[model samples]
Target: MVCLRERMKMGKRSEWVAFCFLCFSLSLQTIQGYKESETARTLKLEQGDAHEVHCSRERSKAAWKIIEEYLMPFVEEERYQISRRCRLHSDNDLYRDQEQHKIHVGVNEWQCGYCRKRFYGENYLDQHFDNRHYDLLNVSHSRCLADICGALHCDLVMDSVPRKTKCNPAAAAKNQHLCESLADTCFPVNGGPSAGRLHEFFLRQFCDAHTCTGGRKPFSRGHRKTRSIFYLFASILTLMLLALFYIFIYMHRRGMKGGTVELKRISKSVQKKKPS
Candidate 1:
């Protein structure tokens, strides 16, 4: 019985030893994993800047064609201010002539799309348009067509299809993702002409305003300030016209009143006097 008891105690001790060994192995594995993770993190940090990759790529012609096909429609309608954000408003515009007016271009001459009037190089066409074709540019709102198409930032998703992509603001997750992707892709700090200067210019000009940078509004605060001034001017002009109308009416009524008093005095004199 004593031997049986000793054997049972030995068995219990062996089981306890096994449990302790198993727990020690688990703890050692956990510690090793934590140390490995720290080492990996330190190596990553030592590798230098995370976004040090300068953009050396240029978009293909097929990509540009896709962009043109998808975006040109919304750009034409009511946004002559399409320059720089959507694209530059220059001689290179695909459908520049079709804007409210038809533009005619010659070897060294630039003609007004609205009136066919001619101008010299660099066009100054926008100023001419704003001054003369003012009616076409004016709208209830000056928001970007991205407010409709949502393609301004999603040029990659836009280029996914060979021909064109539908301009749906609801393209979500995919639509909004490009803004951050483009900061690196479009024009990184290290980006230069070899990375594509024209391409860089295009991306910088177009994406800067459309991306999350510009409060996501195409029209800057300057547009708002100018719009407010325009409204103020219009209000003042309207008030002036109304005031002039009231003054004219008052003058006419006063003249009639004066004439009526004089007539009454003449009639009273005649009545008091003889037939002569």
Candidate 2:
């Protein structure tokens, strides 16, 4: 009977030991799993940060190249490197626009804006840019310098994305002055009344972009909207002017066509003799 009781005690102690071992094993596994999850989260965050940095570098790389190679050589001011208003028209001497212009499409035909070459609909125009102007840009990093291309510069090529329009006037004054001066000096006043109007338009465009009017940035919505409004206004003004011109012509011709009554005048001596 004593041996039987001893066996029962041994069995109970063994069972208790097994239960404690199982609990310890489970707790260790839980700790390891939690640590692994935390490490995985840390790694993911590091990767995301690295990816963002890489993307930013890639985005600005092409813009830096443009600044150094194309713009900086003749620029008088170091600060104007990133400016949209300055040095835009001056860059034309270097064929800058032709190097980076967009493709134009017409009915059943595609034309390369850069080269002025025509292509059939069987091929894509995007492919043409890749082949011709690929060195001018990085297709993967698109929003390189949308806000900084001034005077219709990169209007079609880089204007695909809208730049943040909230310009700071105080910070932007120097560049604005550059643009205004370029307009006043470059465009000829003696050319005609049309030339005067063109100068005024450029002056307004360059300076007005620097101001925030009524707490709202001027949404040019790209050059397309600006050009459309200009054309519409000009068309309406032309029609009105033509109507007025025709009305004046019609009035002059009608007066000329009107019949006139004529009576013969008699001399004083003849009148005296005849009447008497």
lDDT of 2: 0.51
Decoy 2 TM-score against native: 0.30
Which ten-residue region of model 1 has the weakest summed lDDT? Answer: 217-226
Residue pairs with colliding backbones in model 1 are 102-113
Tell me the whole-model lDDT of each prediction, alpha carbons only. 0.49, 0.51
Candidate whose TM-score is highest = 2
Model 2: how far residue 211 lies from native, Å: 12
Once model 2 is optimally superposed onto the true structure by TM-score, how far is the C-alpha of residue 44 displaced, in angstroms? Answer: 1.3
Pick out the ten consecutive residues of candidate 2 with the lowest summed lDDT: 216-225
lDDT of 2 at 65: 44
* Per-residue lDDT over 141-225 for candidate 1, one digit per residue giving the tens place of the 0 to 100 score: 3322332233343344345565544444344444445543443443343545332443333344334444333333321211111
Top model number, lDDT: 2
Q: After superposing candidate 1 on the true structure, give the runs of residues whose Cα lies further than 4 Å from its correct spot.
A: 1-93, 96-149, 153-170, 181-248, 267-276
Misplaced by over 4 Å in model 2 are 54-157, 160-171, 174-276
